[model samples]
Target: MRYAVSNQPEGATFQVWRGVLAGASASLVGIGLARFAYTPLLPAIIGAHWFPASTAAYLGAANLGGYLVGALSAGALVRHARPATVLRAMMLLATIAFIACAFPVSFAWFFVWRLASGISGGALMVLAAPTILAHVAPSRRGFAGGAIFTGIGLGIAASGTIVPLLLREGLRQTWLGLAAVSLLLTVIAWNGWPAQDAPSSPVNEQPKAKSPPAPALRALFAEYGLNAVGLVPHMIFLVDYVARGLGKGVDAGAQYWVLYGLGAIAGPLLSGHLADRAGFGRALRVALVLQLVAVVLPVIASGAALLMVSSVVVGAFTPGIVPLVLGRVNELLAHHPAAQKRAWRTATTSFAVMQAASAYGLSFLFSHSGGDYRLLFAIGAAALGVAFVVDVVAVARSK
Candidate 1:
């Protein structure tokens, strides 16, 4: 079923673009600054003695836990308030979390704020694209959705570049700097959201009968969850792997992160375009294959050039998979706006659960196994391999 777009008066295109930007800003704050920025800062926080290594690691995990909570609750929150209201509030909450983190008054205090930021990120991830895409023409959603998620990549890139510069000033300054950026984005996006009453679906599109998700959707959920696990090694350990594992030092690690950030920035746009040309299903399979190769590359070849390739490819798929999964949800549930939202929430929650589990599980393995980065990457590769096989078999069986 083809999704429908609402009719609009003259100049609606500009409003749609504005809404897309607002959605992007929400993602940047929630995922980019709120989540990704912490990675580059983790070593600095540990090095500064703000908290012991164990405490600091747990604090990092706090966000993932909070993300799960937010994903679980976003639908309820939206039911009570307009999507715009919830989105704006979440963005503000994330900004506040950033400011509160600058003090480090206590581990509990820092953990609460980190967790709050994670909550905001999770809600934003769940709601932003779906909300904005509702106002977009169906024909443009592939690109518009990609444009919205570009915020995540922007956030990743900022963590690599801007966060490093801020760290030079002091930890407090870095947190404050992030807060400032978040605030600016919040304000810019404030008026970008469409009216609360904007039509959820095209007028002529009839609501479909509510039913259990099809097999293809269940397969997508598994694929997305496993993809999260596959991403853990790079998301959590890429910097450390390049800096310490490879004995390249902090500066070298940051450089590799920058490369990762660059790849992330390009990944969604490229993938979205591919989805538009081929199909979300086909695009997703291709992504899984590329990701599998990238994750295993480090384990097989440790050369600088190969390492760079690995970083870029994995980084691209990090946030890149979001659009493909989202598009697939819409494709499967076309003409069912309400169902689309529910499916997306389920998918987001599954992703958060897998990501948090893999992070702690892999971290434990890394420590107990004497910092074996290759072992972690191998595990990640295995997860991707399973995801690819599952997707292929599911598609084949459906036929």
Candidate 2:
């Protein structure tokens, strides 16, 4: 804890440790952990009741929809208030949303609850990036950001591992236990991430002040939005591609996910270090191209060896690219405070919207194509290729 706190910046002394915990906990409970629990837990939940599989899936789509709403809400609200306060409040909302899962209800009600949870959780994720980066030293931003986002991976893995074990007890008991954990996470965020006043604008006194207009905002949104469309098929479908589509068992799929998490942990740390040395934009472009290659693996190979290799490559590609994207966005607007804010907001909100679109598209594809994941995988590969081109153009234009 002391080591983690040492690199935390000045003005962060009283609150840095708490902020990390708050950010990490908010990620764990708000979006990654709580929101994703539905997927792994769905089998157990459905086994206990006799609901249609499609209806259960609707709950997921509803959550993504709520996430889009929450993300937009956070962007609008954060401009007027401190980010930490927004993060804490959203964490509380997400906790309650997760708890909503504990009760047995009709599919329609489940959809509503999930939508609320997604909106809250999405805001929580958006709030976290700025709140953590704003307080940290510029030199340490990438590493700290990586450490912070890793919480999402941890939370997601925890939910995956826990949901199955809890089912051994009973559906109600399983959900109750998860709800308890989410509540604990909420308490941590509310208490640990207490708000601090934002520093006064450093450039307000200068005569050369510039602010981004609607045109700039739209441009940033388009760049980030297209990038996100590429990630959706991969991030949302990786597990299913390995498990159901490839004829592998659930355990093997879980192992592949675990490998992904391990790659996630390693990739970010290494990418951050290298980005500092090689330049963020260049490094990020290389990484995106590599990911494009990784996404195409499923289409060419079907064995365990290819699957394992793909897991490692995709794992390294996905989360590793996040910090760099945010860092570049931060760089692009370094001269304009307002542009910086808008860039971050656009990046986040568009991310959620793209995720929802990806989910809906994948679900529709899976339904109609007679479960041919190959078409979806091909789509994912193409999106990644498009992302590479978009990123190159965006980076060049910014320069």
Candidate 3:
């Protein structure tokens, strides 16, 4: 009866929409304004002032590194801190960093700011997942989680679309404007946020622990890390692979990007909902199959129709898997409050580690392979195949 329905009224249904919006806005500062905007705007910033490409890449990586640390800290800290409070602090840090970029600081100073932004970005993502899902009933958590992940894609798309238009205003102005928007979003999150789900404790009280061994949850954390590797290829390099590897022009690449983003936005919610009804494992298998088709289609057909189809298929399933994965992680740690904290900490740390690995792998592959990314696509397809197997095995064993 734990997952049984309550005799609630129409107004008492799952808060999936609200959770998704909160997730989107929270994610915008982290994924869009802070983390993602830098990619497109970097060229402009470099052009405006001279900086070596290596230094810029390093600075960018610094942000990712910061995310790793922040995620670990937030996962444990969320047990003590209210989710809204943590999100607000992270948002504030990200906003300030964006505005600070306008000041034209020294290379060392810029790296520090980037690091701060990265930390906030990581924290925001980890906190948002659970915070949003907690608002929904347990039966609906999968759908809610998937819906919430759409926020990340929305943020990415917004950054891609907005930064290019704002390039005319100069990087400094754009940075300031992004900062202002972030601050406004933070305020909205503060007012609308629900009460914290963690146990209450006084300032001098010890952090409470729920009954359970930590090792079980730690195993789930390792699985999360593996899942991260499974997800990276389609996300980070899909656009470049389509453009350079497939011989499409920039315009075609942009179109494919739009398609993929749209898929990312839509896929999670649909998959999550389906996962809830059909079982998470079955839903995941379905998504992975579609994603595989998306990955491999370009190997044969490089035309616009196939390219767009590929983007959409890949996009649809890409972000959707996150919610399902987190839901499973949550199931493992449900009995122990302290365990939840530890598990989240592990999830965040693993997330950052995976992202770093994925980025490095893509860069190394491209560098050594003379920018031919077909092999990269093949590798991605293979990884997903393995992930599909894992999902099947996990589900079958659980049953």
Best by lDDT: 1
lDDT of 2 by residue, 63-164 (tens): 778877887788777777877667767776776666677775777667777888887777876778666666666667677666666666666566567777
Residue-by-residue lDDT tens digits, candidate 3, 33-129 = 6777787777776788736777887888889899998887885667678777888788899989988887766888889999999989888878887
Arrange candidates by lDDT, descending: 1, 3, 2
Stretches > 4 Å off in candidate 3? 1-20, 198-224, 334-338
Task: Give per-residue CA lDDT, model 1, range 1-399, as digits (tens).
Answer: 122234434444337778888988999999988998998898899999999988998898899899998899999999999888999999999999999999989999999999999999999999889988876676777878888898999999999889989999999999999999999999999988765544645532655554545787888898999999999999889889988998989788888888899999998888888888888889999999999999999899889999999999998989899999999898777756668889999999989999988988998899899999999999999999999999999889877
Worst 10 residues of 2 by lDDT: 1-10
- Error (Å) of candidate 3 at residue 282 is 2.8
Model 1 steric clash pairs: none
Winner by TM-score between candidate 3 and candidate 2: 2
Candidate 1 residues lying further than 4 Å off, grouped into runs, are 1-14, 197-204, 207-213
Whole-model lDDT, model 2? 0.69
> How close to the true structure is residue 48 of candidate 3, measured as C-alpha lDDT?
80
What RMSD does model 1 have?
A: 3.0
- Tell me how far the alpha carbon of residue 63 in candidate 3 is from the true structure, in angstroms, after superposition: 1.9
